[model samples]
Target: MTDPQIERKLIEIMRIINESDRPVGARIIADELRNRGYNLGERAVRYHLRILDERGFTEKHGYTGRSITLKGKEELEEALIGDRLDFVITRIEDLIYRTDYDPVKKQGNVIVNVSYVDKDDFEKTAGLMRSAIDYSISPRVGIFEEDSEDIFVPTGKVGIATVCSITFDGILLRHGIPVKPNFGGILSVENNEPVVFKDLISYRGTSIDPIKIFLMRQSTSVTGLLQSGFGTILANMRSIPQSAVENASLLFQQLHESDIGGLLAMDNESGNVLGAPVDVGMSGIVVSVGVNALAVVEEYGIDVTTRPVSTIMDYGTMKPL
Candidate 1:
């Protein structure tokens, strides 16, 4: 068995490599370790990498350095399972704290969901995406060509970064209004209108984002909704203090004026929004899911991989799609 301290250092090294856009060398790994308060130098880092390579946890490129292998990812997940409880909610809070987008000024960084699509299918994907944009969290998107550093775009695939609905939560939090993300669910639509939630997975109880679950199950019909005005679409439910409801409404309006509208409904009283209940002191709010378009592309038989609530990016850099 590995020493507990050494095991922790290994996990951190693998995590850093896993999150990198490209293969990382010992120098970069050592620098990252130092930033995280690890005192290991490049030589020590290389020793650890050799151990990882021997264990088949990582693979090395000629001179590009190392990348985590499939086994490595699985091992990391298994080792960190205990620490990932309520991780989705924790990540939301972190992203909210990091979000600094100013809608009034129309600048700053906002949380985004990144998706990768084959370059050949990008045009069709974009058209399909446009069909579902009005139903998406935001109408703006950032496109990254292959080999771009802004975000990982696998070779031959383009990356699309869509504005996440959580940006609303972040903006509200920045203005002193606490927002509580409750669940991700499917909203039934009829005649171009939202009816009720068909399913919900609470963020606090799940390790993974519920939206990703729904997407994986191909549970959304956003394209169907666009074509026939009757289908189930992905959405999220949140709660906020009733006293902050009024202020939240103003902020949401400003968000719309700035062209980031995703607000589907907000309850006036401590009741419910679109049939999802809220606590006594809280008000229910619902918004469209940001990756709804990606689901549509998937439904159309175009393969796409998504990283929901992935990271933050400059809002001004995104373009209308």
Candidate 2:
């Protein structure tokens, strides 16, 4: 087996090359690594690059430097799996910290979930998306047909950006209400009402977003909910300090008036929200997930790959679905 330290250094080298828009030289890679707190010199970086080349993880570009190979990306993902464990919670916290969106001003950066779909299915997808939006955490969204510096649209596909429900958590946190994201799950619905979670995956226990797993398994019945008012949709559970319940409730009202409404239920007395228990001082709350719109499209036999908590975009740029 390779020395763990050396292996990490190689991975970091590939990561730097992979993220670069063009091939990167050893000096550039070395400087980037040092910036990341890795103390590899240009000479040491060249040696590591040779190992990556030998392993078919990188390819040389006529001395212009080196670019990561397809194998490099695969290897990088696999090598980082251990580090990715329990990453969802960290991502949530990061997005929350980055969110500076103001409901009253309706301006600032908010988190969004990006979904890639087949271009041929765009028309039908839009219709289904509107239906799903009615059941989603937010009614606003952004669509992209062409790739840009910030948005990557694959060939023969379109990209849709939906408001993530976590925006609510960020809003609450910014307002002095401590928000604790608990889990993402398939929420059961009857007569268009959220009942309970059919399955739960804690954010702190998963490598990827739980909603992505549920969607991949086709576990949600968002289409069913749209057609018959009975099925399952994506939802998330969170908690807040009991003392902040009133303030949080008021904030939610302001959000709703601003056209951002997805509060399913808030429970403090029962210490539970839709069967998920809350701690003694925390109040449980459930909100409709933003990805439910994409789930509906998926249920209709349309293919979609979702990137939850994908990126932050200015709220003013988004338009209603």
Candidate 3:
């Protein structure tokens, strides 16, 4: 295993290479090291570079220079957990929100306006939305934006309420309100259409009860909560906040030992409320069932949209009605 000192040095090298606009040579790297007081000789730096290249953390070009690879980027991120993660978490938290109102009904509609080439091209759009939510809501979520023309750039704040549009199969559509161009670039175009509207609308058509949807959404919110909590905890870890570290470490341990298919509640101050423990064979089943149940509730809403009478009858039969 690499010692922490060496690992730290390797991470530093990766960070330096990654931040560079052009590939960097070992000599330049050595100079940088000396400037930073690392005092590493050219040979030592070259050795470290070779080690990094061999480990696939970096790549070397023909007789020119070296650059950090994806693995190197990840390694640098993990190593800088004490510095970057907290900033990332704070940025994400500053962007998202949770509200009691319905999205579809709202005037602004928390619109997730999509402008894909085609509606059937759901994968990329969905992926973008999911990624946006994950990054905006969770600290564990990695920064995925790359410096590519094909990649979507988040022009505004990254959390919830901050809106942007994505390209459909080929078309670019905007979500929420559009903004004027600032120093960076022009904001996405505004669309009068609501992407998703939310409000407490009455539903007389189903038997599942409106409260059920609310309950299910709240339950689903648990995942978001955990995600946000994880990010917050991670940020705190990077800052070496004592209380955050202890709490996050304890939570991480519980999560690792948690049943694969089970639920872990954080509302309670206790470590966990695993439906199935890690040692239990049904852990996956427990987790899947919970996720599936939440999905079903989300998709169908509190009331069965299609089988309203049947659902009502079933509910009536189950109760004293």
Q: Is candidate 1 or candidate 3 better by lDDT?
A: 1
- Measured with C-alpha atoms, the lDDT of residue 230 in candidate 2 is 97
lDDT of each: 0.86, 0.83, 0.32
lDDT of 3 by residue, 156-191 (tens): 212111121110100101212111110101011113
Task: Give Cα distance to truth, residue 173, candidate 1, Å.
Answer: 0.2
- Greater TM-score among 1 and 2 belongs to 1
Q: Best to worst by TM-score, what's the order?
A: 1, 2, 3
Candidate 3: where are CA atoms >4 Å away? 83-321
Model 2 misplaced stretches (Cα beyond 4 Å): 1-83
Worst 10 residues of 3 by lDDT: 307-316
- In TM-score terms, candidate 1 sits at 0.81
TM-score of 2: 0.79
